[model samples]
Target: MAEGQRALIVSAHPEPTSFQAALRAAAVEELAAQGFAVQVSDLCAMDFKATLGPEDFNDPRDTTRLNVSLEQRHAWQQGTLAPDVAIELDHLLAADLLLLMFPLWWFGPPAILKGWIDRVFVSGAVYGRTAVFEKGRLQGKRALLAVSTGAPSQSYGPHALNGDMNDILMPLHRGVLGFTGMTVLPPYVAYHVPYVGPAGRAALLSSWRHHLRALEHLPALPMPRLSDHPDALGAGERAH
Candidate 1:
């Protein structure tokens, strides 16, 4: 809520005129009104690469094999990561609040958004042997998922066939964002987006605006803390 505080919204929808775009616009307007500087990364419009490969690194730790984790660390250390990735990483590091916006595909975020994480979240800079959970580089930041789903909200309920939405998103909440030490907020999900009428869409936008306005007070989702599990750091080191 402080002046000059920054918010970055990374949007992954392909269509520029889609409902998701509207949601993003609403967020921008609301956040700006609240005295926060807002930055947007419209992945689809940018034609963001959705795959990580040799090109992502200028200097690889191992030339014979592509070890993504090691290469990411090396590139991060050497400042040799791909240009696009570096730019996104800069934005990510500067943001006080990170909002991942996308339409759910196959019960998860779209491939582009996933790839954004893969490239921008450098292993050494974002997370490392000792820098996980509470000690992560992004520890002071906050992250929230703004997702759109094709199915109705009922289908994603506690006892619904598709399983609870919270359960479906646990990996991202606890593993990716939280793993980097970011405080994860409960997701803002717009269900049955395509099936909803104009009024419903408007209502969704209103709700999103309300959510953004109250972001400072939103409770963080539960996540693992290093102090609670002393062996977790050792386990990570062993895996590496």
Candidate 2:
């Protein structure tokens, strides 16, 4: 990641008036007010393509096709990327913290954000297949997930039809971000988004402000398995 107090906010909703837009706007504003540099990438506005190509599967360096797509090469010379996946990676690398805000769709993040990961979180870059204990380049950064959901929190409890919110998020935090060594802070979620009317939204905005303002004082993301296997954390825990 680049050195600086910067955050990258990714919004994947197709409509600007949708609940996601409002939440994303509120997050960026609050973070900005807290004196952090903020960048917003509205995936819909970018018409981001989520599909990976024939070449992405084969690491360009090792393959004859050179994994680098013509589009990526073109963007490289033009000094601009047409969502080649690396652009987001660059921002992720540069930011001190990554604040992901999205609407939960089909029990998880929307397609474009998932697509962003598919394209950018390349195998070699994020991890290694054989060396399960390898370190991630993003080790020192922090990550937080904020989401807006139509389902009421009441509907998500164990007593309710759906499972806990954490159930839906475990794969993301534990399997992905935490697996990569970026400290995964507790998430922020706004439920019943469709019903979180103007007044409720105002309240959420106030809370969001506090979340952003508290970043500096908050403890860094803990090294995974710090206590369960304290010695196993070895070098990575020290970075935190």
Candidate with the greatest lDDT versus the true structure: 1
lDDT of 2 by residue, 1-240 (tens): 133478888778888787677778777777776666888878888987787775443323334453443434444445444345667777777777787778898889888888887666655555443222226656777888888788888888666778888778877787778776687787788888678789887787677667766776666544454335545534642231
Model 2 misplacement above 4 A: 1-3, 55-83, 130-134, 217-240
Candidate 1 per-residue lDDT, tens place, 110-174, comes to 99999999889999888887788988899899999999998999998788989999999998999
lDDT of 2 at 160: 76
Clashing residue pairs, backbone N/CA/C < 3 A, model 2: 1-93, 2-93, 2-94, 60-67
Q: Residue 113: error of model 2 in Å?
A: 0.8
